[model samples]
Target: MLCVVYKSPNKEGAYLYLERRDDFRQVPTALLDTFGKPQLITVLNLAKREHLAQIDIHKLQAALKTQGFYLQLPPPPENLLAQHKASLQNDKG
Candidate 1:
């Protein structure tokens, strides 16, 4: 089992992606503190595979909170200017 952490492109929040033996799961980033950079902690519960299988947003939040983390949803990705231009040209044509 492996847990990966990533910061959002907008720098607003982060995300955690978990890889297990047979599946993958995503959890919202956690805001731990007010000072310094917010650290996102991802714990791979090797023994709780069964529980994780039925994990919901609230349960995920609670699990993170137990480790002194807070849930934070990251901002959506911004559209690139070039991509936008191309999309507009395609629509016009």
Candidate 2:
């Protein structure tokens, strides 16, 4: 299926995918407010690809079919303090 991709300037690396271009009927108003103005990124054909850079192709397609839209948030920031605590525990062990 062909899907439209949009990126929000408010949050870096965050993307919103829609089943059709400029279609946001399925997307919630609160989400749209937080997502900010969506800048068109690209239109992708899922059937023509095996994988996506950061998303699972199967899950994306499923979401598009069921929910009509998919939100792609950036990975959480690394927690240095949590890592340090884990390392200290390992050292004690």
Local distance difference test values of all predictions, in order: 0.44, 0.96
Candidate 1 wrong stretches, greater than 4 Å = 1-62, 65-68, 71-73, 80-83
**Residue range 18-39, candidate 2, lDDT tens digits:** 9889999999999999999999
Please provide the root mean square deviation of candidate 2 (C-alpha atoms, Å): 0.9
Candidate 1 per-residue lDDT over residues 17-93, each given as its tens digit: 33332122233223223222424445565444544443364555455445423234555677799789999999999
Model 2 score (lDDT): 0.96
TM-score per candidate, in order?
0.26, 0.94
Model 1 residue 58 distance off true place after TM-score fit, in angstroms: 1.9
Listed per model in order, the count of residue pairs whose N, CA or C atoms clash below 3 Å is 0, 0
